[model samples]
Target: MSVLRLVLGDQLSDDLSALKDLNPDVDTVLMAEVRDEATYVRHHQQKLALVFAAMRNHAERLKGRGVNVRYVRIDDADNSGSITGELARALDDGAHEAVVMTECGEWRLAEHLAAFAEGAGLPVEIREDRRFISSHDRFRRWASGKSQLRMEFFYREMRRETGILMDGDQPEGGRWNYDAENRKKLAKGVTPPDRLLIPPNAVAREAMGDVERLFGDHFGSLDGFGWATTAEEAEASLKHFLKDVLPSFGDWQDAMAEGQPWMWHGLISTSINLGLLDPLDVCKRAEAVYRAGKAPLNAVEGFIRQILGWREFVRGIYWLKAPEYRARNFLDADRKLPWFYWSGETDMACVADVVKTTRDNAYAHHIQRLMVTGNLALLLGVHPDQVDDWYMCVYADAYEWVEMPNTRGMALFADGGIVGSKPYAASGAYIDRMSDYCGACRYDVKSKSGDAACPFNRLYWGFLERNRGRLRDNVRLAMPYRTLEKFGEAKRKALAAEAEACRTLLGAAPME
Candidate 1:
């Protein structure tokens, strides 16, 4: 019997489970640019262009291999604007006996597809997504009896299971993490190696035009759009990273510079998340580079941990604790996100710089996401939903499985201590140490209180004082809480008042 195979925008790999058993002549690969997925959270214009271009390219590659592919453009006259609607319309035409699809990344889409299958009265086979190193069952088995799921432990297990960076039975360099060595501040007169910018091919240019015309009012700019939209281009980008950027990646990975958005970063997450590159393959190549004495162990290990460790860990947590996980507001933060987040109109140099980069490229490195925008939101008590939505909408690599845990758990501490051992809360001091943005900032990063003080400075202490009841017992926060006690009630009140004034100036209503 003939079958219909479905491909999501992110599932662009030729080896995707849905296409493994394909009969090129009988099976029609169904790919659609649905409006529902595109406008789910008002995604950035560049994100829209990248996904669409990549999807289009993947479809053409399939067709060139003698596969019958039914591709639906977003602006098609008869387009149904929803995945389920498109699938139902296609099935009703009676070309295929059944529907076959690989499992989707998002819970919402997965549930919708499953329901559609049941309602349509057709035989549907949903295959496992094998692109990731760890399967859901494997992750669940690893986490079954554990009281607390720490990424470090999970990462160690992944290394043992995959034999990546392992010296027989032991870890390379006698350690699983090189994160400590990865925190060096960027030295003066030192610059990151030049990045290879992939120019927009004809397909990408068309997709860019479509995004500009259709999603003009989206959050990000479509100018200077340069992302790999196919597997070949993505592989080339990875090779460039291995050759030029990997050596210094560990030392300066956390360092941020003004007008240098891509500093020592791989910039391949968009491609990897889009199924253009396999995570295991990327990790192995980095290991090979280290083995060859090209890239340092710290840099290679740090890079490998991001994919084999954090990337896999987050996906596992998402699947393990989703649906309810999305509603988690452990801190009870109810404040609305400030308008400056979208407009990049803040006087805080760090926040503005990160926001501008996000708007321009649909990306910001981990440190910028974690310590700057994410840290400020945590300090200011922005609601978890607001924080999650902003993160998911702005980044090209942000699929819900990865974005939610990073935003709600790691960034905002919204899940309490599930994804992270402690809140990633810090004052302006942390920002000043890691980035040069504080040097150009209008507010004084050193000032602890008052109008001229950085908002982060006041908000840090204010957050500690405000949340002492919930966080005081935690061992990790004991020192900060003790310091708050040493400040006495009068100093605490003053700090709170300073935070209130700063929030008022920024037009953020106080969180109850």
Candidate 2:
């Protein structure tokens, strides 16, 4: 009995259950760098490089372990352009059945594989992806009969189930979330923690070149790419985070610094999302830090929530409302994504810094993502598709499943109130409080309308006015509604025009 076990770029686990019962003598493992996957979203150059290099490294690891591994590189002479094409070519050599672990993210890819399996007329076994703490069935059960889904409640349930931060069945410190304490910015003269940097080897460098040449016309830059490509390097990066950075990770997790891109951010998203590190293991490791009395309760708890709570919950929401989930557009915003999104030429310093960092490194922390780039896109009325694709392409951790919900629901409020109850729309004040980018910014964060006033401040009100009819029912938007009423028609029109003018200045420069 011969089996062909397929591994996706993100599914590089050595101990995948599908391989558990594999008769090595008869089983063959398959991995490929398909054009279909890369071009589907016009991903960042570094993203393509990292995934290909990581996949190549994983394939080598499997081969070294004596598994019959077959790898098809993107530039292979006989390569097929898609996953199914490669799979069909592999099947022609006579494989009785196929064993595949479920896809980590992206419903579209999963559907493609399922349809391919059916077309092949083989008993395709789709194994559950056990890497996550929350299962599909568990999410289904949790969401069943729920009128409104809230992350806080779901997070509490997870705390009980996992026994994390629990003291004899009660939450530690008598609280489930320490978000209030976690929101503090770095004090004056406080030095930020150093981040781990994995210098690319020859293979990754070559892959980077390939990506640059292929995706030259795409958004984001290829300069300053440094990401762990192998499992060993990924594990080392995680250990470094636990030892050096995790202590103050909570305080600065949401903080942004001007000219400083990696302010205590765990750059482990790419590695974790790529399957080099497991999220459960990451939580357990963070918990160990608390048990060892090395990291504070707030720091450990905050880190744990991102992985165990938010990460898992988002995955559940994605599966629960998928297919229809992609089409959800609560706000019905129709503006094209401003050219500045790609150029990073905006006058807003926070936007400039984050976008510049993204263009340079293909990375940014969640706060920089949500409150900075994502916030501007939503407030400025960039079309959801444009915003969604930009996010999906620019970030290293982005995949369709995670990026879509976080962008559409949390950032753009496109899903009305599914992933987030209300839009995370905010004036420049939020950026002023959270980041130093505003201090040196050309645009005044305080001003709502003048030429030197921050476009975000003006656009913030403009967004509320534009969406009042759609979002007026949301109780959370009441304050903004009142503020909009105070502005009246004339001021609102002037502000919208200023914002539109600012948007027009984007992408006026020639591409380098």
Candidate 3:
């Protein structure tokens, strides 16, 4: 029987479940660059280029392996512009007897694919994606009866299961976490290594051209598109990270310089999310580096934790509480995301630098995401939906499963502490300490009020006051709450008013 096998842009792995055990002679691999996905959340131009180029490259690989392949480009004259529309049109030709596909990445696409399966007329088999280390069933079983889920605890379990960096039954170096050591600011004149760039190949250049012509209104620039478009390129990038950058990764992982965006981060997230690089392989190699004494235990452990801990943990949590999780507004924040987010037209040096980096490279390391843009959005009382949308829109590595939890749970505290122990809200002092953006800023980081004062200073206290009823009793927040209480009722009210004024001036607060 001839079966039509569908491959989504993100499912480019050679060993994808749907492609396993296929009779290439009878099975035709189907891949398409559909319009709905590219424009779904106004995905960044680099993100669009990366996925489309990768998809095109993977299709050629399959064809080279003697597989019959049918590939559709975004600008094809007969394109139907949607996944289901393309699938239905393919089935209407009666060339194939059945349909097969691996599961999709996002909730919206999953629902759409499920609906297509229900009515596709032919028998359809949607197989599990085994690219990730923790399967959906594995994560669900791990989280079955927990009152509250935490990534640290879940990460330990993953360590035990994988035997990664485990010294017998205990963690390597007698500690499971090296996050404390990872927070040191970059000392003056200490520079990060230049990032490895994969110059756009012919296939990638075609995709980039298509993105510019079609998605001209997208959020980011395509000027320096350098993302790996195939598994081999991704592996090469990973190798460079381990050799040149991993040694100092733990020491300056959280540090941010004015023009430095990479800062010792492993820039393989786009590769992993796109299935060009396997997550477990990335973790195992880092562990091997620690065992070989090439990289410090602190650096290797921190790097592994991101993949084996937070990355897997967030994916599990996303499936556990999604659809409902996205609707949460525990703080009732109602401000719109400001225009400066798009234009980078604000005096806040940290935000402007990060936004510029995002537009240019379609990437900013985690600290830039969480501490800079994400922190400011939470303080300005931007609604969770707006915050989530912006994060999803701008980054090359963003897919719903990873982006939503980080935005609502870690960044905005909109999910009310499900994905994090406490909101990552902070004042300008934190930025002043970790980065040099404060030194060049027009506003004073130490001041607590007035126009020339840093906006984060006033808004930090306001976030606490606005959410007091919900957060006052939490153990993690006791210190901040006590500090707010010491300010007296009058001082607290004044802080709230100043915060409101800052939000209004920043255009975060909606005009009535």
Worst 10 residues of 3 by lDDT: 503-512
Off by over 4 Å in 3: none
TM-score of 1: 0.99
lDDT of each: 0.92, 0.83, 0.92
Instruction: List residue ranges in candidate 1 displaced over 4 A.
Output: 510-512
Task: Give the higher-TM-score candidate: 2 or 3.
Answer: 3
TM-score of 3: 0.99
lDDT of 1 by residue, 1-512 (tens): 89999999999987999999999878999999999999988999999999999999999999899999999999999999999999988887888998999999999899999899888787999999999999999999999999899999999999999999999999998988989998977899998788997898899999999998999999989886889999999999999999999998999989998888999999999999999999999999999999999999999999999999999999999999988999999999988899899999989898899999999989899999999999989988899989899998999899999999999999999999989988999998888888888888899999987878888988898888888888999899999999999999999998788877777777677545
TM-score of each: 0.99, 0.95, 0.99
Residues 15-98 of candidate 3 have per-residue lDDT tens digits of 999899889878888899999998889999999999999999999999999998889999999999999888987888798999
For model 2, residues 306-379, the per-residue Cα lDDT tens digits are 88888888888988998798888777776777777788876777887888899888888899889988888887
Error of 2 at 491 (Å): 5.1
